[model samples]
Target chain A: MSGVADDTAVVVDQVSKKFRLFHERNQTLKSAVMRRRRIVADDFWAVRNVSFEVPQGETFGLIGRNGSSKSTLLKTLARIYVPDEGRVVMNGRVSSMLEVGSGFHPELSGRENIFLNGSILGLTRKQVTARFDEIVDFSGVETFIDQPVKNYSSGMYVRLGVAVAVHTDPDILIVDEILSVGDGAFIEKSRKKFLEFTGQGRTIILVSHSLPQVREMCHQVAWLDGGRLRAVGPTDEVVAAYGASIEAESS
Target chain B: MAASYARELIATRELLLNLTMREVKGQYRRTALGQLWSIINPLATMLVYTLVFAFIFRAEPPPGDPSGLDLYPLWLMCGLLPWMYVTRVITGGVASITNNAGLITKVYFPRMHLPLSVALSTGITFGVELGVLTIALWIFGGFPLPWLPLVVQAMGVLAMFATGIAMLLAILNVHFRDTQHFVSILLPMWMFLTPIIYPISLVEDAAARAGEWILQVYQLNPMLHIVEVFRALLYDNRLPGAVESLAAIGSASVVFAVGYLVFSRHERRLAELL
Candidate 1:
């Protein structure tokens, strides 16, 4: 459509990542000195020749089965893992809600983790201070903010993480199945926030197994099968193809 | 490349500050004694060492010095304070990457900030402990007033050197879990090699023949110069002559450079390794 859209927020050009599976990790002095070329059992390409362009303000859904390179592709896009080949260019502030409680320290209070998670998500101290009340209210963990997060129930933890991520105001947001962690009410709240974020012209890349949600939320969708792109296009067409493939296999 | 690293560091400074505060608070949180335990840990060690040397061994003060200062505890504390801080930072630093696997795997901040935050956290404790020692010195009337800057400078040098080493060790430990065990064995031997327990002057007197060569080799160990600088500032009036000070600073800078280089080089693999 219009040859690579003018407002491209993220561009991944033929990116690939290979991880060598070592039979025995040879880090010891004796093993290193012996130098009998340690075995490489296999080279696993976690993301192989994956390419896509996400335009600014677009809601892009990445749908795939488990071990289908969805998470790996997100990580590479997030710059957590460097691609072994090709390149990824991003023209905005990117924040990933890869794991809901990724930055929470167990011994820290919910209030402390708010600042921590906010900072990790690239919000400055002044920014977090200004939005502190909004974040706490959004999470609905107001009364227990001073208590250590170790005391937080699973529902509270997920809610707080989502609340922080939403409030950080990143230009490019990546959500990886984090919505599945929280309660039903929190999920509804998260969806509202996600819609608001996208409405404000922020790019959102969502990786979820829920095909119906992907079809509803995404303008475009990409399907990954075994570390390779199976199909990518309008959400309805791609999802239908993915469904057909899955049903045929099941039959 | 350097500018990018510095920019990345500046970007993550907030995270470093928050993590450091978390570390300090987490240690004392829910504890009966709270922050006092930081002071108590080193003081307790000093008491045991003092008892063994003064009562059991019947050790005496420096010859011909009628000040009657029980300098053993003072000497022990001087060396022990910095040594313990370094050891704690190094040991805890390794876990900085491994323990935060969740953050490393998910987030895209400079991973060097993790170990650096640990070093900075320990550094706060070291500063507090130094304040305690200052009061102790004043109470004993053994304050080396003129050399205060030198002692402070030595502590700063040692802290920076240790920060560099800790950063390197943390990245390595993520890849090779055995580094943790190797460090446990290495620290004690490192202490013995440094003139921590016995002064370099004492060792020199004990072995006159090969003492110069041994002392020169000892100088090669950066910590030896650090401890010597500490002793010079606290006990002796001024820093070692300009030549020795320059040598020590040069060695420390080299180690720090190497450590940072190694840490930054390997940081990319930390997520996979962890």
Candidate 2:
């Protein structure tokens, strides 16, 4: 799938992120002051020195079981978490679809949210207006577009969120376990959109728990285990290796 | 990295505008009074303040120097509106980050924009309040059109100052939940310390009686100069003297700079902590 032309889009160069496991639930200054500084905490490295590269136009997938640090790596790529060690370098505009309705105001109408959410994603008002019709059409929530988003059914809310994020028109997109939430029709629509996105020579980094879904979509995959990359290669090979490792552990 | 604050601000100006408008639109929705609350709330404050000082205490602040108008409500508001602006802006700023922890965590944006938009939205409400006060001043004081530009300038200075404080407190509030609670307690007390209700002459007289150093300590209040500046322009219809202007703008700039520095240092780790 990704053998078209080789140009690197994202490079994760030995990046590591450390998360602190706090000993106390205190988030107030009084306790911190009384304690002379910070509360007791143990350092947990969420992701170790894991490195990988995605060629331009490649649909790359990160597959691992729960607590495998796949989502942390994805977040590091999204610029949500600053890597405590090493760095991540990217060659294109990056947008992360971590959550569907990130900046949506509940009281705002869907039509208003389109503009508000678009602006939050750094799109100008004019750009949001131009793509306004396309977004509404894609989401298939024309009737509720003018109604407050709080009134929308759960499916409608997610579908609209997906539409805005998909239309951000980024060179690189970071997705985190969101595709599994939408209805089947919407998920199919999103799948087709990703294919079209890759056809334009853009790159996508998806973090998913579904192995078959990853095999169906991504050309390459990285399997993370306990904060390190256990395997990285073609989708079928790496997924098979990951499957084997799972069997070995279980048996 | 936020390479340049000005550059980042320029880049995200549209987003700032949208966020500010979001606050403005969301604030008054699902209510009967709607946007009218912006005007009514301040007017109500004026009514209570007038009842307390003008009626009970019989506090007669100096008539406007040139306009020769002696309306207590107008003069009180000229000072009180700016005070309220600072208070509201700071509260919005302190809560800006914590309140939007959802948006901040899910998306990677310039976190500075949250407090900034809060200040700006508070500024909008302040602008509406000032407009009504200006209109009232005109009705009683023969139209203060000549001093309107200075009023606008003072608003800008106060806004910059308030936003700086907001930015500082917002990041701090992220670390200390008590910050928001503490600030709510301090603001009303801060208003009393600033001389919004009674005239500065009352404080001057008290200081004169207590000791001259008390006057010095009392004068150290930045809001004193700032409120006086607002009073001088809007109520008294005069320039805020070169020294007053310099003092007001200077303190505001310093607060803003410190706010910027503190906020920038803690910005990157915000997503993790929150």
**Per-residue alpha-carbon lDDT of candidate 1 for residues B243-273, written as tens digits (9 for 90 to 100):** 6577668877887788888887877767766
Candidate 2: C-alpha lDDT: 0.89
Question: What's the lDDT for candidate 1?
Answer: 0.82
Model 2 chain B: lowest-lDDT 10 consecutive positions: B1-10
In terms of lDDT, the best-performing candidate is: 2
Show pairs that collide, candidate 2.
Answer: none
TM for every model, in the order presented, reads: 0.94, 0.97
Clashing pairs in 1: none
How many clashes does the backbone of model 2 have?
A: 0
